[model samples]
Target chain A: MGLVPRVVVDVMPKPEILDPQGKAVLGALPRLGFSGVTEVRQGKRFELQVEGEVTEAVLADVHRMAEMLLSNPVIENFEVRVEETA
Target chain B: MGLVPRVVVDVMPKPEILDPQGKAVLGALPRLGFSGVTEVRQGKRFELQVEGEVTEAVLADVHRMAEMLLSNPVIENFEVRVEETA
Candidate 1:
């Protein structure tokens, strides 16, 4: 089972939620001379390696995991993208 | 003063930092049939519109802000790139 599986999951807090980290970072732009940057939202990207054909079951499971465990459903939304063999 | 400056700030936690969120997402890959990706480190990308010429001084200020305020240097490293007028 040397098959290497990779997955990229990108998740971000919804616009309504207050992302202190993102806000603090966004605010610092002008003071640092990055004057025109606006609307900075922080997110997550994940890459993984797995085994088996890319099936709906696998995608569903990953999505479920993201919604129920990996990310906070109340404030964060996640997207899971799967890729096989690099 | 309608010049637009776009800045992409990509920052990531140093390898040593334990990213639970990233790890959880990485772990879910096999369950999702994504079996080729490895070493997924999360980072930030900032796009901004600012006013002024791309000068060394501007770059320096952005760099300093990223290090001192925007990003947590103890756990994060960032790169500031500036583009003027779209």
Candidate 2:
């Protein structure tokens, strides 16, 4: 069997969507003396240990998975990065 | 003034921490026809639009911010990547 690959998927809320979490962080930054942080958007990241190789087909499958499970298609956008960790 | 830099920070739960969200995704994958996904770890990503250049000092500042506010240092780890967007 081929070595399993590691995948990192980042899911972010759409620019127009309201992100309370992000806003909360932005609010807290200045208190921590992290000034000049104009804006912040909080999102989700999924790190997957897959039972297969990193291939175009596998990436497509993962993308589908992201669209179907990892993110809300209407309000979120996701990016998939595949790595051959094994 | 230097161009604003976009910084991406990824925060992940410690390997041993129990991640209910990750478990939820793993469970839902198969039902969505995405089999062979042995494991999944759910985490958070922060996209920051900073009013500064992407420099080492800026990265270090972001790292400090991550430790102080972006993550639970006791059970989470974070990485910061900076990119020039202007």
Candidate 3:
């Protein structure tokens, strides 16, 4: 087996949507003595090791997967980053 | 009110720990026609907008926060990236 393709998918809630987890963190920052922390947004990151080259086709497939399963398009947005692991 | 610092905190389960979410994603990939997806690791990313400069002291404080509140040291590892939002 050769080196695999690595991809990172960052999925975050849309700015207009309310992020309760982020809000909770923001609320607790000051209590934790992290007063400088003004805002916080919690999100998901998926590191995918694909069994192939990091070609355009692979990147497209990954993007499709991110949209279809990794995130909810209505209230969230996602970014796909293709890395050269080989 | 100068430029603020943007910090991205990434928290992921240690390699030895069980990641049921990642496993579920890996298992579903093939069925979803994503045969090339060999492995998947799901993690959390915290995007924090700090109300100060991205100084060394600020980075250190962020690291402390990550170790104490952002992640469970026994089960996961975390990374912190300091960015300029100026």
Candidate 4:
């Protein structure tokens, strides 16, 4: 089977921003008997399957998508990268 | 500044499962004038900061944590990896 190129965009909350969801997870870990984890921050991961070769233009478009829709620039930072191709 | 070891855990919905959030993003992309992206999948990324060195035992514990707390094995798949260390 032919797989299309895939791009991954990760959106994480800004360091100074409060991550309530991550805090909840952190609170639950030790209760579940898991230790050594001192902090937890949760974010979103997006996998985009594109129709053609992943060129510079494609990556630039992906970056635009990340900034415009996948993440909120005011509260989050996003990273875009080509994950795989076929 | 001293940086601690960090482990990343990614939890994605099983391919066969319907992802309404991803669907919403896919539908919005074209309306925003971004094309060529045929599909989109949204998932969760977790960054865990550990208290000390990331050893084999730490990784094993993280794997167990991923299986038990980070993902729903019945409908989601999870990956755990050590991202960076200090």
Which one is best on TM-score? Answer: 4
lDDT of 2 by residue, A1-86 (tens): 45556899999999999999999999999888888788999999999987646778878889999988899999999999976655
Q: What is the TM-score of chain B alone in each candidate?
A: 0.78, 0.85, 0.88, 0.90
Local lDDT at A11 for model 1: 68
Colliding residue pairs in candidate 2: none
What TM-score do all the candidates reach, one by one?
A: 0.54, 0.90, 0.91, 0.93
- Count of clashes in candidate 1: 25
Output the number of the lDDT-best candidate: 4
Residue range A1-86, candidate 4, lDDT tens digits: 77656899999999899999999999998899998888899999999888878889999999999999999999999999876556
**lDDT for each residue of candidate 1 in A1-86, tens digit (9 for 90 to 100):** 55455555556787689877667777766665556445566655444334455567767766775676556888987778865552
Error at B86, model 1, angstroms: 19
Q: Write the per-residue lDDT of candidate 2 for residues B9-85, one digit (tens) a residue.
A: 99999998999999999998887778878899999999998764667777898899999999999999998987565
Instruction: Please give, for residues B1-86, the per-residue lDDT of candidate 1 as tens digits.
Output: 57555555656677789877567656765676555435555555444333445567756766776677657999977768765542
Ordered list by DockQ, greatest first: 4, 2, 3, 1
Q: Which scores higher on lDDT, 2 or 4?
A: 4
Residue B27 error, candidate 1, Å: 8.1
Scanning candidate 2 chain A in windows of ten residues, the lowest lDDT window is A50-59
Off by over 4 Å in 4: A1-4, B1-3
CA lDDT for candidate 4: 0.91
- Predicted complexes: DockQ each: 0.29, 0.88, 0.85, 0.89
Q: Candidate 3 lDDT, tens digit per residue, A1-86?
A: 55555799999999899999999988887788887888899999899987647778888999989988899999999999976655
The candidate that achieves the highest DockQ relative to the unseen native structure = 4
